[model samples]
Target: MSASPLKILLCALEPSADALGADLMAALRKRCPEAAFIGCGGALMAAQGLESLFPVDRFSVIGPVAALQALPAALKAADRLADLAEKEKPQTAILIDSWSFSKIAAMRLRKRAPEMRLIKYVAPQVWASRPRRAQKTAELFDGVLCLFGFETGYFEQAGANTRWVGHPGFQAILAHDSDKAAFRARHNIGAGPLLAVLPGSRAAELKRHAAPFRGAIEKLLTDFPDLRVVVSAAPGAENAVRALAAGWPGGAFVVEGEERFEACRAADAALAASGTATAELALLGTPMVVAYKVELLTELWARAVLTTPHVSLVNIAAGREVAPELLQRDCRPERLAAALAPLMRDGPARRSQIEAFPAIARLLAGERSPGDAAAAAVLDWLGTGKTP
Candidate 1:
């Protein structure tokens, strides 16, 4: 390894992606400690000394309405990021998730500094929907790093240099993320059924999921009066969570910030909005019922192009319905309650999820740790590492 630092540009658009970026940065630093990280990300990556050109939240938004409103700012940030890359001329630029923002920056970087090794850190779900994006990604980046084993064929066939680096978060979760009893004791939660509610992290998610989610909790409370509810809100969505919880009756505890994980660990089962949270719950060995409700327009759009059998990562990874899914109109409060009731009491669905954990773990685990592989791949693409 060289004593001289390598200036590597990295961008992460959301908390999950920021986490992956942080782990990758740590690994890059271990092999090359003086490496300088620059570009956009959240607190986690900022702690790794990332010289962010803008706040990571500037790039976070979901749904057509929110995305439309945020477009101008998002474009300005992407152009600014590309300008930063052109000015600094980093050896490489690794764009993590947030396909919307990353692709724009990638195109801009290619326009100015065509020689920079532009790597797509996490491939988008093109195989599931909008398959044209595979060729689009191939046209933009020099290489692609995939998080799942099954994703390689899509990018490879599209003519992109791709590698399955596994997911660093999965390894981190399995290693240190579960502590059920401690969570219960800290929150004063009893052995009686504890249901976790994870609405979502983004503002749009809060707006869409909060009301219906509250209705579901209320429905459950009527039946299981002793049941304790812990609403685990995403980082930026705490105020929204509190606001929604205020209208609710007794027994629902709202946990946010770092203390939020306590909700996941403390829960008997979870009613979660479909996304990465479902996978996290599965990794925690907690059974969950996943649901999603987008605007009718988006739902229609999703139905038109969606190829995947299930939406939640746990079910997707299981290659079948490990956790029951209720989407669109089916995500009504009554339906949500119906689906979640069994899991709260260790029903068949819960047992099936528990039994499926080992397989999910094996499917996601990398031979080497995720960070080690991600760092090696990035460095190798940059023509630097002395091979581990």
Candidate 2:
């Protein structure tokens, strides 16, 4: 008789999480070819053989206030996930990113299916904000697969079994071997100055950042007329990205879908929305100015909880200002121009960012592959042999 397939209920609520889930699913499949997945995920995981119980788009909104606005929808998604977990009774449930939604669903799942081994992929930046979230995580998850090494110890201290799995975001950068010159040539971009503009992958993020990023570009255009612009359009954020990219004073080229990383590789510098792409920018050794804007109410409360001095993960890992982060009013066009101008050209700020990449890569890429490491951790938690 054939061995029973390991049943996993995996939930990923954003682009970054979806990609991680896809990678983990592949790694797990190699070990347990008959493993079946049931939960929510995007195209990548679906392609990796996850036929989700519901669409992934339902849980897309991010950030504090923005996430609050989507609470009703998010709650519905969370409830449905809990219901699925109760009915399916998967041996394990791996909640990837999306803390708010994951927390709600996890809590309910634990109550409904106490036997399910709950694992959380990508620990929250409790080191950055909401330190007590570690305690909350301990209460919610049986195990947490962390991307950073420090996170493993931090959460372990909080009474949860957490493992260091490096970071898939940085690994994506390390694995990608794109030729900048060829990429630039293909895009018909001259070497004088190429700017990569990333206004984030979510609708709320694009809505908040597109105008300021555009204004910054316009401001730079006055000083550098020959500057070439490439906007990194997030998958599923096409219309929003087009609306924003279309308005750039000096025409901007949009790179979406699979080509986004190529655009990152070709850019001289980037004005990016503070997220996973920052890791890619750092991996490509590109100088960057990270910008983020949140609703006033959210920013006000976030400041209180946020303990880290830097916002960009690259800088956070480096323990210094590798990439300058402009948040709230500091993310204004004039301030953004001031921060980005030096990066667009060769300067100390830009050089510092470049110097920081190797360490970031080293810190993120442990001895083993991040995706595989995360998968092994999950399998071990499931009492399944961790071998393909």
Candidate 3:
């Protein structure tokens, strides 16, 4: 008789996580054709055959203030996930990013289904702040699949089984052939100095970044009248991004879905929010000025806890500021405009950043695709009851 189908649970609480989960699910399906997926994620994971337990948007928040605001709902959702786990009794539960929510859900899963293997897809930023989380994460999950090679040591030192699967975002960005002319033609953009503006993926991020980003763009338009702006809107933030861009001085064209990459490749410089988007821009060889802002209380807390000098992943990986980061109070219109001005022109500032990108790309590249590596790691654990 054939073996029963392997049932796995996956929880991805944000669009980025949803994409990661989707890639993982597809790769897992290739390896274990009979595998069944349950739990929660967004549309991407849903397309990959996951029957999500709840809408991921409810828990998609950033920083302490937003987290506190969403806590009650998040708690209920975590419990619901635990309840689902009890009923489904999947052999494995893979929790993607959104660290706090995953931690809560993992704890509940531990209580309800102690026998089931729990895995964390993305390790917390222990190297940057909250180093103690490595030990806590080690205690919670059976294994961790790290996105960066540097992440493995922390988790391994804390006594967790860890695999460095690299970052699939890099793989996707590297593989894509972005057509600059096509993107410009599609939007009727001319051969002027073009700028790609990526605020962020979340609604909260858009709300925080909109004014400053707009201010910067308006300031830039005065210096470069022919400056064409393209706003790359993330999955759930398209409407907000459009609304935000509409009020800009010279007007901005908003691109969603796959076209964002084209805009990234087409632009001379990018004014981007510091996150996964920065990494994507780096991989595309786009010189950029990275900026971010959060609640005042969160900023204060972050200032106290953050050990790293640079917040951009490209900067962190390079061990230097590959891209200029204007964060919190420094994320003002004039500063952002000044920082981007150098990048938009053909000068040493632009050349230096672009030159540094290949090395950063090499640092992130793995022997195989991240999806295949992650899927193999998960399957290896299931087969041997150990992390490979």
Worst 10 residues of 1 by lDDT: 379-388
lDDT of 3 by residue, 21-72 (tens): 9999999999889889999999999998887787878778767899999999
Sort by lDDT, best first: what order?
A: 3, 2, 1
lDDT of 2: 0.83
Which of the two, 2 or 3, has more TM-score?
3
State candidate 3's TM-score: 0.77
Please, what are the lDDT tens digits per residue for candidate 2 over residues 1-388? 1245678999997888999899999998898888889998999998998887777785687467887888888778878888898887788889999888778888888888987888889898787888899999998888888888756767988998888898765666678777888888887876778899989988889989977898898899877898889998877888778887885765698888768888887888899999878877887788899999999888888788888888777777777877888988898999998888888887787887787788786766555787889878877766653211
Question: If both were scored by lDDT, which would come out higher, candidate 1 or candidate 2?
Answer: 2
Q: What is the C-alpha lDDT profile of model 1 across 162-235, one tens digit per residue?
A: 87898776666667654778778877876788988888877677788776788888889877888888888776
> Which candidate wins on lDDT?
3
Worst lDDT 10-window in candidate 3: 361-370
What would the TM-scores of all predictions be?
A: 0.76, 0.75, 0.77
Clash pairs, model 2 backbone? none
Off by over 4 Å in 1: 1-26, 32-93, 98-116, 168-172, 201-225, 247-250, 361-369, 381-388
What RMSD does each model have against the real structure? 4.6, 4.9, 4.3
Better of 2 and 3 by lDDT: 3
Name the candidate that leads on TM-score.
Answer: 3
